[model samples]
Target: MAPASIPRRAALTARALAVGAVAVALAAGCVSSTESGGARLGQAQSWSSVAGGPPNSGRAHAAVSDSPGLVWSRSLGAPAIGVASSDGLGTFYQATVSERGCNLFALTADDGRKRWCLRLPTDGPRITATVDGRGSLFVPMYGGVGAVSAEGENRWFADTLGIPTTVTLLDNRHLLLISHLGIARVVNTQTGLDASSELPLAGEIPPADPGYGSPWCGSGERGCPAPGPAAVDTDSGTAYLTAWTPGAPAPELVAVRFSPGETGRLEVAWRTGLPEGRLGVPVVLSNDRGQVHVHSRDGSLHAYSTADGAPLWSTPVGYRPDTPPAVLPDGTLVSGGRTTTVWRGVDDDHSADAGPAPVVAVRPEDGRGREVWRRDDLRQLTNPAATEDGRVVVAVRSGGTDDEPGIAVHLLDGEDGGTVHEFDVPAARGPVSGLSVDDEGRIALTTAVGAVYLLG
Candidate 1:
């Protein structure tokens, strides 16, 4: 493999400065939260990390507006790679690609003004970058991870890891990076150096093939190039990742354990097989720590025990789900997709027609899934986000007639799956790139045409 290209540091005057770690205070009544993996990450305010921290529960404690209007929209003039992440301190960060190269932009959350834009030096596409509680940003590139201070200054770039597939913030001080070859490494957030040794995934990596086309890591078949993001359980010191290994016809959900302090050897705890299909979505864990949910393309949502990787139950979703499920505070699972069924009776013969997808809510009980409610009016729904007060927010693509596509953002009641409030995305496109909720109940939605909209 080729080495990562290092950039010049003419403007990085703080490269040699020893930045101290910032300490965060926790409430006295939150003892159970301290045991969970998210508490150590220290990002309680913003969508500081992807899928809202290491657990990837896709739940936010912030409250969102029922009838949110578009606060602002800015076009990147290029396509964006992933969703924009926000720092609770009033700044939003996004990454975009163009003919020139990859650029990371920091915009003011209130007004959408460019605070600073930094050009990233990488050989390939970059995954969604994550931020720490101290306002530092960690981006996964082709070969390594780059650390940028909250002030938009380059701090340090760790270039030893090879072909990063995902970069996850394990805590306030450590980042867990999975490479394209199914290898995991830990990096210190403060120093941008290797915190521990690398551990290979479930199976041995296949030999490099020069004939393969571009290795797109975003969304595709199971293990298209490498594994997707991981869901970490800090209480057990284990991370659940879905990977494709040799001799397995399909992908397997592998459990790997690592020390959160980034000072111990990474170990493989257990591995289990998933159904054969496109495995693009990451795994989600129940807040009660009873089950880990895997939404596979095989038209089913599988659950397993977190202690020993034992199969608990599997629920058929009726359609291939394209996004991860969001776990509400009451342990209810909310998932949505693009296709649905509509029955048409012709001459007493019932035929099925394709209609807009419905957002389904399921409750796990007695080792089986019980359907709670379904909302069929929403169209082209993105991955859903849960608010602290038990509401679901999703972006719907409005089919338009002309060149410009219409977009609608919906807030649903968690109990009955009813539409509480709805708003339109002004001057946007069809495909919704990403959806995230910040600590202040602010919503951020990104589009394929490089459009970013902030709603509150």
Candidate 2:
């Protein structure tokens, strides 16, 4: 009888894992953040990180006008799998998720020209990238979190217990990441090593122990598993994340409070359950100052006090929330669903759709959103992008089947719901990571095929 044959690569991988404990400890020398992650160059655009700064407010500081021609469109020649980010140094960071090569490109925001491209250690279709205020680019890839200097040089790679989700830079020194196995860890941004726990994700879906796995870590899945990205409050040092445990009726929103000073400490600040997963990714909406909002997958919006997990207000946003609510300077709360809805100021009991309406506005105290305006024919599929000039920007698809594609960028006056200006995009509008706006009001929209449409 022939003996069972084991894959050579599998055997080597298992053996390697066994000996890695020593290597990780020896190589875990720490480095300090060479510079402050919050330092912004004068030329830096207001949009700092992917989620637009630690409070995780998705609004651009300033929204560009509606009528504008495409500045430039550059193709990485590969699918743009993850989110895009920028720093104070005028560099836009984008990554290509390709197996032949996964290269991180640094492009000039002025003309979208490639400054430099670095080949990452492994395929990066799932790699998430972020840049600090000082221009350090960080990404989760090749089984660890990696940092690239402002000059585009590979700095260091730290081993994580599991393939991490989108990393959150709490500060120049501490980084927040969670593995698919449901373990939340704080790694020294300088060292990538978690001395306290190793919740690995390479081989086992849930690992050998169930406690190490995330709530929804699939057993039959082929690749890595982890909860989505995190919503972090930099000033308060609190991070909000969500997860689903198997057999559980609802998902869990966990707040991790970081004690950052001389000692790096992480503790669960609070935990709550939502009706469904509708809250969306990086589920918490925080200003990092006073109030935090959490949306349930069940079309419910709940606001909580940041100091202690106390309920401030609860509003039922009739339609299921597809994106986080963006707050304008004037205090208007903007969100999207089947139609564009606005809470004149987070003050009303704005409920769902009543009739066939395009835009609705009401006060949270009203308990029902009143349809302020309607464009019966237009179907908006994106969150209402708030602008400084008092306009809600939306990307409208032609509803043209995939074969006949059209994306119309629309700008509506936030005060009167009037069309400010509209531009047609030649790119296909399948779905994107939401519109990216800079301090200059330049808007960027990337289509399904990795083509970026920039408008100023």
Query: Candidate 2 at residue 407, lDDT?
Result: 70
TM-score for each candidate, following the candidate numbering = 0.82, 0.74
**Model 2 residue 285 lDDT score:** 56
Stretches of candidate 1 above 4 Å error?
1-41, 122-126, 160-162, 206-225, 260-263, 276-278, 338-356, 402-404
> Which window of 10 residues has the lowest lDDT sum in candidate 2?
215-224
Q: Superposing all C-alpha atoms, what RMSD in Å does each candidate have to the true structure?
A: 8.6, 8.8
Candidate number of the best TM-score: 1
**All models: lDDT?**
0.66, 0.54
lDDT of 2 by residue, 248-335 (tens): 5656666677776555667777766655453333444543355666666465566655666566666655655444555555545555
The runs of at least 3 residues in candidate 2 whose Cα sits more than 4 Å from the true structure, single-residue gaps closed, are 1-45, 121-127, 193-205, 208-226, 276-280, 336-378, 381-384, 399-402
Candidate 1 least-lDDT 10 residues: 21-30
Task: For residues 1-456, write the lDDT of model 1, one tens digit per residue.
Answer: 111123333113212221211111111111122123233245546676657666777887688886888888888786664667877767788876544543678888889999888766432232466876556677765345667766666566665334555577666566777765567877776666677787878355544541121233334343343545778776666778777764568777788887654365688888877764444567788898767888776677888888878889877766655567888888888885541111111222311112355688888988888789887666644668888899999887565544555778889999998889888777766555578887778898987557889998
